[model samples]
Target: MAKEGDGADSIVAATITDDAPTKAISSQGMESINATATAMTKAKNAIVVVEEACTSSKKPEEPKNPKTQVLIVPLRWMSLGMTRAKQQLVLLLAMRLRTVKTQMMTSKLQEVKAEADEKLKSISGENVLLQINCKALKNENAKLFKGYDDLEAKYTSMKALVKEKIKAAKSQAEAFKIELEATKGTNAESISKVAELLKSPPGFFKKQVKEYTTMVSTHILLVAKYLYPRIELEAIGEGYADGTSEEQALKLINDINGVATSIFNESLDL
Candidate 1:
């Protein structure tokens, strides 16, 4: 009985001597701590009661049989030792609970940090892809603008050339009319035929004009196909019909502008 009490005392002393680091805890943890403290307090009171009983038993008493004294002494000592052991076990259990809670909290924090890192990596990857796509669009836009400028320059030059040719043709026609008036008396038939030719274009010129109209139509069709793949051209015109929302009409207009601009730019490149 003495040995048991000494062992219990040693364990209690060791547990008390160890440093328990202080930590901030939540309301739930505080409740657990309060419950454990209450249990320890009860165990301490039990120990006090057992000690008092043992002390009272030790006091001098009326004469009794030697066998009875021996039995009573051992029993008292056993009860005291058992109470001390129970008190220490309660303390031990409280400490174990605190340690386990700390470990669980630490593990939970590590898991949260790991999940945050994974989400950050995914967002970074998406940002990189967006950046790459933006750069590609910028490059394409630059090329389109360059092509548009070149096409504009060519159109300006052709317009100037056509104006000059028309001016030259008008000057020649006026001079020929002045000469024809002087020659009409000697060559009346020839003059009449030349006048008729001047009034109406030759058949070859009409054929050339027709071929030009067809070529322009074909080019327009090709541009439309390039700009709006998998969509019917008639559907675009239908978008402007009755019951179309204003926003939808505006979107269609913008789409048409984009297609026309793209076609013009591409033609300049060619």
Candidate 2:
């Protein structure tokens, strides 16, 4: 019985020794769980810091509304329309100014044309007057030329009659001289008859010469008074038509008068 009791005590002592090791393993497992929890907390704090830094560095987005966007489009269109209206007003004023300038130019052109027409009318009137005067002068010249031709014909007839009278008187004087020589110392009556005959012929010749001289002088004076002035007036008209100076035309007329005066004086002397 003493040996059986000693074995039972040894068995119980071994069992207590196994139970102490199990309690020590359990305490080590609890310490490992606490360290893993602390590491997880540190990782979570680092992720939160990264998220805040990224949000601060990025640009913020502006808020947008549908009503504000639609209102901006209409305001921009109104501004564009006002600008176009101002440009159109400036263009209209420029066009009006151009129209006024064109009207003024047209009026000035019409005035100039009116003045030119008046000048042309005046020139036509002057030309008509000149034509009328020229025709009258031509008629007067024709009448004077006819008168001069008639006077020339009469003067030729008078010269022929004076020549016949001179021939008859010379023949009678010769015949009386021959008769007186033939009847000499014959009779006083015969001699007295011859002497009377000679005196008669000489007296008739003297009377004829005086009458012819007086007629020639009167004719010449008539031509000078009536024909010469008309001829000088015609010459002045011609000079004016030929564009001669007034002084030169006057000098030519004076020269013609001087020649006519000299011809008249010579005829009187004859």
Candidate 3:
């Protein structure tokens, strides 16, 4: 600004010098003075106009703005990346949980199968044991049956022997009864003498005869005790001694007496 002002002042000075020459006041000098005056007035007005423009229109200091501004796309890209990372993390966790669940299910299935197999094995073993027991029981039953058969055969033989003994004792008693009847009529004198001799030895047929005679006397007493109005068990003339089953009655009593005598004989053997 100072340089510009100086340049303008010098122009004014030169014009005055020219117009006011002065060899000193010539026609050139007068023209130079008039140009100088006009020029100076124009310079003053221009200076005033410039000062007003500078004061009224010039701006105050501006805030400094950076050469490069923040961009939108890169921020958006970062946010999208963060969201994708979160989604990946969640997916990975879910996949791991699924794998764990599958493994647990597989293990449970295997355990159940193992338990079932164990139970089946136990059942099979029990069945085998039961079969063996059944076979053993059958064998024992067969042996028991054979033992029963032998016992039955022995019982049958014993029954037959007892029957034979009964028959033999019955025949001997019948023969003795016949011999006593025959002697009763034919030996009267001998009977009197024997009775007298037995009475004299001591008392009651020499005392010992009473014991030996008791069984025969008891049989005769029983026949006479409940004698009926008539012996209706047989034909009127042919007596009970003539009846079909009379032999059985006689044999039953004889067998009882014989069994007693045999027991006495066994005492002598001992």
User: In the order shown, what is each candidate's alpha-carbon RMSD?
Assistant: 25.8, 42.4, 37.8
Q: Per-residue CA lDDT of candidate 3, range 1-270, in tens? A: 112223323422443445322344446545643453344333433323322322332322322322111111121222233333322222222234345456767999999999999999999999999999999999999999999999999999999999999999999999989997775443445556977877678565455676555544444344544575454433433544545484475555455667556544554464
TM-score of each: 0.38, 0.33, 0.34
- List the candidates ranked by lDDT, beginning with the highest: 1, 2, 3
lDDT of 2 by residue, 1-270 (tens): 112223323322433344333344344444543343333233433223323322343322322433222112221222333333222222222233345446657988889989988998998898899899899889998899999999999989988988889988889988988986675434445547966765677777867766865666566556766866655544433546566775565556545657756665777687
lDDT of 2: 0.50
Give the TM-score ranking, best first: 1, 3, 2
Those runs of model 2 whose alpha carbons end farther than 4 Å from true positions after fitting are: 1-98, 177-270
- Model 1 clashing-pair count: 0
Query: lDDT of candidate 1?
Result: 0.58
Compared with the true structure, model 1 gives a TM-score of: 0.38
lDDT of 3: 0.50
Looking at model 2, the pairs that clash are none
How well does candidate 2 score on lDDT at residue 162? 89
lDDT of 1 by residue, 209-255 (tens): 66654565456776678977886778654556788875575556445
lDDT score for residue 236 of model 1: 53
**Per-candidate count of clashing residue pairs (backbone under 3 Å):** 0, 0, 7
